[model samples]
Structure formats: structure tokens, C-alpha cells
Target: MTRSATTPRPDAAPETAKTVSTGLIIVVLAFCGTLVSLQQTLVLPLLPDFPNILNTSSENASWLVTITLLTGAVGTPIVSRLADMFGKRLMLVVCLVSVIIGSALGSISDSLMLVIVARGLTGIGTSLVPVGISIMRDHLPSDRVGSGVALMSATLGIGGAVGMPLAGVIYQNFDWQALFLVSGGFAVVMLVLVMLVVPESTVKTKGRFDYTGAVLLSIALTCFLLAVSKAGTWGFMDRKTVSLLVIAALVLCAWVPLQLRQGQPLVDIRTSLRRTVLLTNTASVLIGLAMFANFLTSAQQVQMPAETGYGFGLSVIETGLVMLPSGILMVAMSPVAAWLIRVHGPRIVLIGGAVVMALGFVLRAFLHGSVLEVMVASGITSLGTALAFAAMPTLIMRSVPITETASANGLNTLVRALGTSSASAMVAAIFAAMSMDGMPAVPRWEAYQLVFWIGAAASLIGALIAAFIARPQTIAEALRVPGEVVATERHEVKRPEAENEVVVGGVVTDERDRPIKQAVVTVLQTDGRHVDWGRTDNAGRYTLALPSAGRYLVVVSADGWGPMSGLEDLGDADLDQIRMNRRLLLTGHITDHGDPLPQVMLSLIRHSGEYVATTHADTEGGYEIGLPPPGRYVLTVVDHPTGRTRSRAVQIGSTSATLDLDIVTGIPRPRRQPTEDVPVR
Candidate 1:
């Protein structure tokens, strides 16, 4: 088979080469991410000056920022899907080039329309963040994945926070065009670095690009966000705003079923709806709104005049300086965020982040009397933002297939933009409507405080939502080349409508309450002879048919797990009546000629010496198995190629048991004798 330039050849790199290359790859990708984010904050300090410079009304000049938001929201999923289809590094290069061209255009443009178009082009690069993440996952070693992802995610906050102060200083000293020129220069440097260092993704989803879905989604997002962003200027009830809302709603209603029918959809609505992915994305939206609330309000708060009684009366440069600590905090805390994800699941990290963010806003609401106070509060929230941002992508990656990681991550980023737009509109409306007669045309201090409280509420809601997210069923997905399935999805076995089978059912879970996926629960006669059997779903729920209801033993086995056996009286019952306690625990290891052999398949053999259930040994050749009833059974190693077999006669008890195998010659194949009990074929 021929290989492409982007696909990493398994035999090409030594372990040392991969170790050295992975570090440079992470740095280059993160730098590119940082540069892309600089654009998000680069326009903030220039917004007020743009109207006069470009000879446009303030409303039209606002498009300089609005256009970017609109385009970024629409570009994320499209660029992500493209990356998966073609290659991640290839698409990232395209994104960086777009940013360079956009920045260069804005630097030279004198027309307001030209500048807005330039900003829109720059927004297309926002897809870089998610695609970069997909690239890292595809390339990084398993142990390094958490840190690399954390650093990449933190670039958003770092760029936004650091860019503000840097933008302020540049604006104070140089021409307005210098801002775009500097950004353009940064993009160029990053483009070069990415081309030199980042490897192309080997995980490709080969399919026709969903052009129709792309267009439909872009229209829906653009209309929906435009309506939200303009709701403050145009009355909420204005015909334009209402019309956009109607069009967006109608488009989405039709888009859902269309995507469901397509063979290669731009977005997988089914995967997105998985409990883990759905809740995490929902929390992402709320957290984005909460994070944006800080961006929307804090800088303005410090720049407000002191006479307002709550304003800090700081200059634009000083305002950025004050918020600078939080940006640094974001980058600094990345390792900590990564560590938390490695030790605890992303769900726990997400909950902690949401609560921390809520507390930061609560502090801002009551304690905005001093810049020091505000800065400290901002730092707290930034820490939370760092944690949440890092954890969100990990959750998305764990839940999505390798083929769709980029696309799924892209959809998540788009949802986050929705939150940011909502925050802009919500904060704008609050401050505008609550204002009384005032100098500097600002609202009452209470209005600013109220926005913080609303932000706090959003964070709390995010925390609540995150608490309910379930962990992924199987082992977290690992990055693999295209066509390698990392994890198997648990789907229920459909039963016939009018079946007369006596059904027994229960849920199997590990010690941590996570479902033990791919477990086989066997229903055997009272003497460890199989009668009927079924496998557990990804959720670890299983149902088996009982040939007759007198007495039976159930055994459970999963890959890397030891066998579990228990006794239960079906007692002539239906599905609801069978509630076997699936709590047996057994552990063991497989070795060949005294050397541990991982990935060996083991079968749970019956007392009849028949293979009934199967499992695989893990990386260390260790396995854990849970069983239903404690009984004597023969565990066999079904070595296919060698055809050498080993068996261990083991008895399970109320507690856990261990049975190790050396597989030397064979364990004499367990002295089998013919049984009178009917053998399950």
C-alpha cells in the first residue's frame, strides 16, 4: 500500500524521533493558536477609533468586530470537517494563510466595507484552535496528550488577555494600521513555524464534502447570531431581528432530519446527542457566556470615570495592564488543568471550574470598589476558565470517533460562540436599559453589578449541568490512524415484539460506577453449563433469556477483566423480576514462557469445559472479570495461531479472586469429562 505525505508511517520513526518531534509540534501549534487568538482581542482597543478613521458611522464601524464574530461562528464547523477530510496540518496551513491575507488587507484598506470583509476573512482562522487540537490528539503520545491539549485550549484566554494590553500600548505609540501590520507579521511567522514543525494528521474521514449542509449551517448561524448581536441596537421586536430569528428556526428544523439521512453528514447529530457530549457542550455555552461577561464589562468598568462612584478612572492601556494578570494566570494554570483531567475525569474538572467562575463573578458584583479587588476577582475567574476550556475538548474527544473528532470539536467551538454573542447582547441590553441621567453616557453602577450577578447565575447553571454528565463507557478513546476503531459503541440488542422468552436483566458496573462495557453475561444451568447468554451495552445493561426458570448461574467477562460468577434464582420471572447482583470481581494475568503477553484473548469456559464468554488481556496482560454466581469453572486461553491452550480450574467466592496463567505447554487442558447436562451449542 502507498502512503500519503501526511500519514505517519509506523516504521518511519524511532521512539526517540517521536519524542523529540512531539515537543516541537506542540510548541509550534500552540504558538499558531496564540497568534490566531490575538485577532480576537486586537480590534477591541481600535473599535472606537475606526468610525472616524474609515469615514463611517459608529454603527457601521461596529461591523469591524461583529463581522469577525459572525464569520468565526460559521467557519468553525466547516473548517473542522474540511480538516478531517483532507488533513489537519494541511487545513491549519490554509487557516493561517487566510489570517495573514486578512490582516494584510485590513492594514491597507481605507474603506469601511473593505475592512469588514478583511475581519470576516480573519474570522475564518478561528477553526485553527479546534483543528490544532485534533492534530495534537492525532500526533501526541498518550501520556503527553493532556498537557498538550491544555496548553492549546488556554491560548484563547492568553491571546485575549495578553493581546488587550499589547494592543493598548501599540495603539498609544503607532498608527492604527500598525495594529493590523503587527498581527499580519505574527500570522506570517506562525505560518512558517506550522509548515516546518506540525505533521499532517493521519486520521482522515474520506468522504464527499457536505457542501449543502455547510451552506445551510452557515446561513442558520449567521442569521441567528446577527439577530442576537444586533438585538441591542435594533429593538428586540424589530422586523429585521424577528425575521432573522424566524428564518434561522425554520432552517434548523429542516436541517436536522436532512443530516440524519445523509451518509456522511457535516455534523453527527446522533453522537452530539450522547449524554456525555450533549451536557458538556451545553456547559460550554454557559461557560462561554460567563467568560465573555468578564471581557465585556471589566475593561469598560476600569476606564469609567471615578465620578460615577464605581469606575476606576483608568486609561485604556492601564485597563489592559490591570487585566493582564488573569491572562498570565490562564497560561500558567494549564498544566494544573491537564493534571486534574488526568487524575480526575473531565466531569469533575468541569464542575470545579464552573463553581470557581461563579464565585469570581459574585466577587466582582459586590467588590468592585478597587482595581486590586477587581483584578484579584478576575484572576480567580481566569483560573476557572482555564480549567473549563481545557476539560471541554477532552470530553468531546473522548466521546467522538477519531474520524469525526475535528468536526465534533468544531461544532463545540461554534456553540461556545453562541454563548459569547448572547453575553454581548445580554450585557448590552442590561446596561442600556438600566441607565438614568449620567455623564460619560454610562448606566447606573447597579446595572454593571447586575450583569455580574447574571454572569454568576450562568456559571452556576453550568456547574449544575456538568454535574450530571456521565463518563464515557469504555476506556477513553486513544488517538489512532484512520480506519482503526478506538472504542466500540454500546448499542442495545433489539428484541422481537411478541417474543415468549423469559428474560433476566441487570446492570453491570465497575467499582467507580462507570459501566463495564462489552461484558458478556452468561445464563447457565445450576451446574455452570450455559443455557442462554447476552452481552452488555455500552451502558453495561444486559438481558438474557432463561430457557427455564428453576435455578441458574450467571457469569460476566470483559476485556482486561477477570471472570465473575454468581447464582440467582430466576424463579419463573419476566425481565423486570430478574435483578441479579452483578458484583463479582476476579483478576489475573497472562504470560507466555514466563513473559507477560498483553492483548491475549481469554475465554470463560463452563464446568462442561465449553467456551462460553471471552475477554482480552490489557497492556500488562492483566484482566479483571466480574461474575454473577460463585462456582467452579475452567478459564481457558484460546490461543488461535499457536493452537496451544491453557486452563485453570478456579472457584469464585463472595469476594474477589485471582488466577494467573503461565501458558507453558498448557495447563494439561483441565481433565474434561462428558456431562449429562445438555450442552449449550
Candidate 2:
């Protein structure tokens, strides 16, 4: 059966390993995700001492944090795309190795520059969260996917909450190298568990990696993130910050149009444009900004000197302990959030979560009588963040194709990171400007209150946006599975005959060179045996495995476009891009007893009784309907005014044609010959 042009081609059958324990896989993946999150905060307690320890300026020592943010921002999309193209498990393992290497190097080195390099390498592991989530979607049963995603996402909060206290305890007992040692050790264990428990995903999109797109996106993200992160220190209007922001904006302006035209884009911008996805991502940014304010200020509130009138003067360890309950609340709320999502849908959950977060932030803005009060309010926000974060991946996965889960989730993760970066900048700026009057002034109580109020506002705005987000229209859309293997059943050649097939791939485009998505490219052996067939992805690229790299017939077709076929010698070389010039359509006139039947309805159906398209005759009796791939079809015309109807069989070939139908006798009338190219009044 031919694939429908208007719908996504059926996915390949899911490939799962029955021996792998799903529970064990979730444990390993969530643990790894938590480890990655821990890396972000592990050095927070050490940041104050880093300058003296490494004999470097405080500004230079900050690169340890800044570099990772840069690398993680740049790496998330690229690594996620590679995961979709390569095996998810393979990328998972690669990411784990990078973490292990970076951690080990940092554990042994004291040089600021070397540790920054190590941290940059470790940052690559941040992408493993999305890839792991994709693996859960591929392997977990439909009933368990929500919970698995919640657990994975909750790790972001879990590790941040745990990292500071854990770092404090370790720093007081041993040297700072111990922290890296612990992270590297956990990575090694997680890597082994991943290989043993997590099954490799079978779904992969076939295309050449879009290196140019990747490079451009990296430059853009790096510049933008740098500007936002450094704006507090450099001044918002400083030339350096402004130049970076300008460069980032200019690069994005060029990058978007290029991605739209690319045969294989690193990020699927078209899917991102869908209402559900677009709004969820927007809400993600706001929710992220609001949620991070709790993390940023909760411990600081506890550590403030008692003389500040709203201070507790707690030790670093004590402050970390005080704030740890918020992370615990996040974890405890995961199953609750998942249950909410399963019942009311992700959109409702997101909105509810945002509302909850907004209320929590408002409470934080006013309820700081003691550490206990601050902890309770922070925990409430964390609970809401658990719901919001959990719902985002579900919304994204449901809206995007199964093959693109990693990259789509990666983009969402990237946006959330953007929100957090902005939050960091805003918090720093607010604190710096609102300092109390003293030699070494501290931020006044009002600064913290202002941040909380801003968080509340961001949360409410996110909730408002979530209210407008569209939900998936069907249950099947929410639960996409790799259905059937188009590769195995569709191939005409015997499986044993093509043991050593080589992969050939290219893009499909129209006459105007616009990429045509959902087009099918079929490869056949010279003697009429079909080696393999593939469908174009969102970027209009397709791939086929040809037997033994010899000569083969390549056939490309789409529903409304003319079919094209040619023989080409297939090898390791890239196939030439295929272009289809004719957008076949059946245009004709409807008549009744030799008179025109204007404003009549027409339907095009296939010979096998499948619906193709519908159109209506214009005032001049002319009607046009797009034709499907070359086939026998029946065109029916109905005149509503006279209650007359007619049906005629049509044979569409590789070109456009015209016909005229006689409704009175149910017979087709001959088409009129073309008139001369002369002006008519």
C-alpha cells in the first residue's frame, strides 16, 4: 500500500529487548540525570574559594561555571539531533564517557584553565537527560511513560537540591577534588548500568547530519547566552554585551531561513511552529524562570547575616540542609504530577502547575518570618515545578513524531536553560542595585521580595500562555508507537539476497527547489526486485539501502506530484537530489445537457474506494482537484441546484490533464482545444 502524502508514513515496528528490566532502566537513567544536574551545583560552594586556590582572579575563576553553560547550551541540540540520527543508546554511552573523562580530569587538576576545559566536557552530559527521556518513551509501556518522564525531569531539581549540602559536607571533610572524584565514579557506574539495562532505540531518521546548521546554531546560542549571563557584570547597555546580543540576533535571522530551506535541519522548526509545541515552549521559559528563583534565593535567605533584620546567619551546610526539602518535595510530587497528566492531559496540568507556582511565589514574596516559612514556600514552588517540568516533555513528545522526540525535547530543554540564564542575570542585577548601606553592603530584604514578586508574575504569565495551548486532538496522537516495519514487508527482493546492501540517500524537492516532505523514495534492483524504500522526513530527506551498491532504479513519488523514475549506478557516493516538476491535478468542466453546471461539487476517489480530494466547479463550470500518484480514479460531480449527479473514471499519468463531464448522461465530454494567445474583451 502507498503511503499518504498528507499524513505521516507509518512508523517501523518497535524494537524492544524483553530481557531488559524496565524498572531497572528507569532507575539507571534517572540516576544519571541526577548526576548531570549535580554537576551544575557541585562547585557552587567552592566558587568563593576557587580564586584563592587557583591563584586566579575571581572573574577568571567564574569561567568554570560560565564555560559549562556555554557548552551545554551549544551541545544540547547538536547531541540530541545526533541521538535521533545515530542510536540513542550509543549517544547515551558517548555522553557518559565525556562526563567520566571530564570529572576524572577535574579531580586530578587544580589549574583554572584545565578545570574549565574539564567542566566544558562534563557539560556535554547535560544532553543525556533528553536522550534518556526519549529512550523511556521508546521502551516504556504507554501507561508508564508519564511517570518515567516525570522522574527524569525531577532529577533536575533533585540534584540541585542535594548537590549544595553534599558539596558542603565534602568540602569541610576533604579537598575539593573529592567532589569531581565522586561525580566521575557515579558516571562510571551509570554508564555500565545504562549499557546493561537500557535498550537501544530502533527508531532513527536517515539523513546526512546538518553540520552547517549545527555550527550556525552553536554560534548563535553561545553569543546570546554569553550576553545574558555577563550582562550583570558588564552592564546591560555595555558595548560588549550589546555587541554579543546583536551578533546573536543577526545570526538567528540568517539561521532560521536557512533551516527552513535545508533538506535536513538540526532542529525541526516546522514542528516547533505547531500551536501546542510553540506555547508549551513559551510556557517552559516562564516556568523555568519562576522555578529557578526559588533555588537561587532559598539558601541565600538562610545564610544572610542576622543583622540584616530579615536574616538567619546560617552556615553553608545548615543553609543547604534547610533548602533540601524543596528538592525532596519535587521528587515526591512526580507521581502526583504524572497521575494528573494521565487524567486531565498535559495542558491542564501545565496550567494548574503554573497557577500553583504563582501562588507559591507570592507566598515567598511575603512569608519569610523564619527559615521554616521560607522552606515551606520554596517546597510549594518546587511541587508546582515538578508538575510543570513533567508535563512539558509529554506535551512535546505527543506533538512531535516519535523519531524526533530527543531533538524536540532537547530544544525545550534549551529554552528552559535560557530562562534560567535570564533569571540568574536578573537576580544578580536586582541584588547588586538593591544593596544595603555599608562598606561591604548586602542586598536589602526588599531585593529578595522583588525577585519573588517577579517570579510570581512570570508564573502567572506562563499559566496564561498554557491556557491558550492546544491539546492533541486524539488519544492515538498522544500515544504514538512504532507501528509496523515498512522496510521488511514492502521490500520485493528476498531478505537473504540483499545481505550486503549499502545505504543511499538524498533530498526530494519541487520544481521551484522547495523541499517536499512526506515524499516516498523507492529503490528497485535492475531486474524488477525492490531493494528498499524510504519516506522523506520533515526536512525532505530520504534514505534507502540498495543491494551491493550496483545499478538500481530509483522511483520518487508524492500524492499530488508526478512520479519520477530513473536508473542510477548506486555506490558510496551521495545520490543527486531528485526534483519533480509536475504537480499533477485533474481539472475539468461540469456540464448538463451541453450546458455549463456552475458551482457544482466534485469528489475524487481512488479505484479501490479511497477518498483523494474534493473541489467545486467555479462560475465557468471549471473544477480542479489535486491527483494522487498515477492511478485509476473516479471523479464524481453533483449539481445541487438541479439535483443531478455524474461519475466518470479517470486515468492520471505523469502529467497534468483536463477533462469535461456530462452530468445528464453520466458520461465525460471531450475537453475544448486550447485557444490562440490573443487578447479577449
- Top candidate when judged by lDDT against the true structure: 2
* Tens digits of per-residue lDDT for model 2, 1-681: 111111111111123324655678778888988988898999988888999989999778888888888998899999999998887999999999999999999999989888999999999998999899988876665456778899989988889988998999999999989999989998999999988887776557656898999999999999999999889878999999999999999999989987876656898777789898999999999998988887888878888898898889998888778877878788888888887876677888899999999889889888888888888888888888999999999888866755678899999999999999999999989999999887234899999999999999999999999989864443222333222111111231112222232445677888687888878777665665445565576667775544355677777777677667887777645577777776667788888788888899999899899998888889989987765678898888887877877788888765567888878877775443332211100
- In candidate 1, stretches whose alpha carbon ends up further than 4 angstroms from where it belongs are 1-12, 15-20, 472-681
Please list the Cα RMSD from the true structure of every candidate, rounded to 1 decimal place: 19.0, 12.6
lDDT of 2: 0.79
The Cα error of candidate 2 at residue 602, in Å, is 29
State every prediction's TM-score relative to the real structure: 0.70, 0.74
Model 2 spans > 4 angstroms off: 1-18, 439-441, 472-681
Pairs that collide in candidate 2 are none
The window of 10 residues in a row where model 1 has the poorest summed lDDT is: 492-501
In the range 321-404, model 1's lDDT, one tens digit per residue, is: 888788788888889988787666678888999999989998888888799998988789888999999989988886665556
Using TM-score, give the best candidate's number: 2
lDDT of 2 at 77: 96
